[model samples]
Target: MKREILTLAFARAVSVEFIATLIFVFIGLGSALKWPSALPSILQISLAFGLAIGTMVQAFGHISGAHINPAVTIAFFVGNQISFLRTLFYVVAQLVGAIAGAGILYGVTPANTRGNLAINALNNNTSPGQALVVEMILTFQLAICIFASTDNRRSGGVGSPALSIGLSVALGHLIGIYFTGCSMNPARSFGPAVVMRRFSPAHWV
Candidate 1:
């Protein structure tokens, strides 16, 4: 009976993660799609991702801790917040969810407007090394924010955890977008690349 209960809990957690990640990728990338008359501004795109993540967290945090990103799941594992098997399940769910979300976006939008489902790439002449540094820094900041906001022992002084995390994501995108299209989550980058079949060596970085 105990084993059955644990299995059910694990299944529920995986399902929640998958659903949250699907929502995150779908809404976030959909906001960046090039419409006929208007292109999304950096602010708009940033908010899309930020808000999506924040909303997903709020919606599913109780169920699965809303770990929609593979990086976040790995961080939780490294911090001993989750077991290795659970971490693996969460990461797999997130990746699958991301791909499903991107795939749905691809199916709905016109072919011409579906620009690789907003795959992350270095803008301008930014070198691979520079892009890597920027991504690392942005992800590190995000990870720290996650740890702080979600720490139940920490005293709260401001808004909800969702809002704080959302704002951080937006801020990161505002800065990192110009350099590397702001991909702090590997799953976010992987989904579109897989759906569009547009893998570049830089994407692996």
Candidate 2:
């Protein structure tokens, strides 16, 4: 008997994770990028990130559960909702997707307009400790929102998982952008940094 990991369904999920994360990063970072026309506002970036997430969730949630964020994948694994092997594969796929997305955006964007690939960085006034706390709190909320929206045991009370998850991501960015460029999802932070090869001291945050 073959394990579920080797099945077609598992392969499809992994592929979707890669594609979804790639598109998500491309759109999310593309929004924050400083264009020759005009710089993206915080609200613009927030909505872009949120919309990207919502679109992806609605598009792929059925196949891969749309755990676009590694934090969400790990959270599911930690809660015993997913197998460790599945979590590992999904995280790997997402990370690779993110890097590819950032790379593609970099290639398409003008050199002068490509400002640091909109990489996440700590604010001058913000210490690593402060950034860590902010990341934790914001990510925790996003994770909780994802969990609640995706839970199957609920008796039909949950409404619009995609919208709920997307809005939660936007809410995180509304404040997180000021501190750490709002990386509730580490893959979101990691993609541009790897592509740009520009890692700040507090890049982990």
Candidate 3:
């Protein structure tokens, strides 16, 4: 791909990223708080997240490749699927999209239900190293799935890319939720952190 500062493709990609992320956060966070009672089952929460991602990707995939996660974007860049300049633009767009998503979630939700906007972190006894390892493992699988599902050469096209992507997200949440609330997407964590004013070094990790 040719390197350009800002092109129509980049803009569309960024806009799609922002809107998709906003929907992801709004639905995911909304479920975490509003439906906490009914959504006590981890499976329920996982499905909620998964379904949100699936829906967003279906809605926005054609517009921006449906990259709602920064980690996936980084890995794709590392995998040489995207150009450097494009990577920079995508990352910035993802971050801004994340913040916008979080902001909208904060505004729409009730004050009592905010709960720090569901910031992700280690549980009571998990170590920092363990958390990192877990995040890496989960994110690796996630990024790999993104690469595979989006790869025209590899995919059979039996399932929608949106469905596959959402399934991957839910898979991570199933295992990582107990570890670090399963923040496979840094933008997902960062957006809420910035909004709740609880941005921490750990979040950067």
Candidate 4:
């Protein structure tokens, strides 16, 4: 375990997780902010998040597998695709990166536009149980897509895994935004909540 962790490639992968997550959170929340010029639409926010994840995946997938979300990382581990230590380190890195990204956005954004930093919460009177199920189904689809697209054991072409994964995220948001603000990834929600210093009960769900 020690030898594995000490390897240069392992260190590089961990670092990439942090950097990729930081960028993902920064752009995703930045796009959702309430600008003085105009309020961002749901389609805009969904596409922004999708584009951010897709771009990061394309850029860093080769380096670290680019699991920007903790849920995806955990899912990979649960599926026996990665070791426990790797999953643990990746989760920590992603969380730290998310907080750092949200912090930086908080610093750069105008105060009036911050508006909770796009923190996920229960919307449309969604019950915690209902939101929980919604989140599970949405995350399940994304995780399955990630696993299917990136599985090296596959022989045939997958046709742009990054785009597939990204569109999956956007597709989730299209329905999820009306429910729990679309928290398919725990890190995505946790980061902004920590930065904003507030979290609702549904956040736990």
Candidate 5:
């Protein structure tokens, strides 16, 4: 019975991670795709990424902690919030889900409107140094929020973790959007690049 429960837990965890990643990629990238000129505004796009994250956390928090972002997972792993094995599996699941999400978006949208799967890239105006600074700042804030909200021992359960995380994601996008479209998460960047085969210079390690 113990072995069975362990197996079940592992399955549930990966499934939760996969589904959350899928939702995150779908909503975030969907908003960035080319649409009718009258489509949603930039704020709306930011909010979509934020809200998708907020709700997904609530929906999958128990089974997987609903990371849905590789950067968040890596940070948590570094902080000892999750096991190394779990982190490895989480990253794999996230990448797979992200690719699946991008593929789905491609199939649903018009060929011309696919928008390169919303891959993040440094705009022409930004210097490489500026781009690096931008990503560091954006991800620093995001990591700080994740550490705070999910640190149950520290926060003692104050506000909603989902809300906090989503807000961080939106905040990063607000600033990083102009520079890098706010990757904040490597898996978010990876899947689209793999799908579109348009890896940018910044995408290289």
Candidate 6:
């Protein structure tokens, strides 16, 4: 009976991660699609990602912790919060979900407007080293925010972890977008790159 319960919980967690990641990538990338009539500003794009993530966290936090990003999953694992098997499952689910989200966006969007599904890339004049540093810093900030806001011991002091996390994401993108297209999440960068078949060597960094 204990084993069965654990299995059920695992399944629920995986399913929630997959679905939440899919929704996050879909809405976040969709916001960056380039329409001829109106292009989204940096602020708009940031808010879109922030709100999408916040909404998912609120919807799924109780069930699976809403770990829609592999980086977040790995962080939790490193902190000894999740088992190795669970971490592996979450990472695989996140990657698959990201690909599915990007694929769906490709299918539904007009070819001219898709814009490589918003794959992360370094802007001109930015060196690969610079981009890497920027990505690391951005992701670190986000990860720290997530840990602080979601920690149950500190949860009482925070009004909404979801909102705080979302704001952190938005803050990262608001600045990082200018340099590395703001890919704090590897799954977010990987999904669109896989769908578009556009891989930059720097992406692995």
List the candidates' TM-scores in order: 0.95, 0.97, 0.90, 0.97, 0.92, 0.96
> Local distance difference test, per candidate?
0.90, 0.94, 0.80, 0.91, 0.84, 0.91
Q: Per lDDT, what order, best first? A: 2, 4, 6, 1, 5, 3
Top candidate by lDDT? 2
lDDT of 1 by residue, 1-205 (tens): 2353378777998999999998899999999898878999999999999999999989888889998999989999999998888888889999999999999999999988997789998887898899999999999999999999888787656458899899889999999989988999999998999998998879866
lDDT of 4 by residue, 108-204 (tens): 9989999999998887677889989999999999999998988888988888999999999999988998998887888889899999999887678
Report the Cα lDDT for candidate 1: 0.90
Expressed as tens digits, the lDDT of each residue in 1-205 for candidate 2 is: 2397889999999999999999999999999989878989999999999999999999999999999999999999999988989999999999999999999999999999999999998888999999999999999999999999888899968999999999999999999999988899878989999999998888877
> Each model's number of backbone clashes?
0, 0, 0, 0, 0, 0
User: What does the lDDT come to for candidate 4?
Assistant: 0.91
Per-residue lDDT tens digits of candidate 5, residues 1-205?
A: 2343368788899888998898889888998887756565678779988998889998999888898988888888898777777888899999999998887888888887886778888888987788888898898898899778877677356598899989999988888888987788887888788889998887842
Model 3: how far is 59 from its true place, Å?
1.6
TM-score of 6: 0.96
lDDT of 2: 0.94
* Stretches of candidate 2 exceeding 4 Å from the true structure: none
Candidate RMSDs in Å, in order, are 1.9, 1.2, 2.2, 1.0, 2.4, 1.9
Judged by lDDT against the true structure, how good is candidate 3?
A: 0.80
Measured with C-alpha atoms, the lDDT of residue 203 in candidate 6 is 86
Checking candidate 3 for backbone clashes, the offending pairs are: none
By summed lDDT, the worst window of 10 consecutive residues in model 6 runs over 1-10
Which window of 10 residues has the lowest lDDT sum in candidate 1? 1-10
- Of candidates 4 and 1, the better by lDDT: 4
Better of 4 and 6 by TM-score: 4
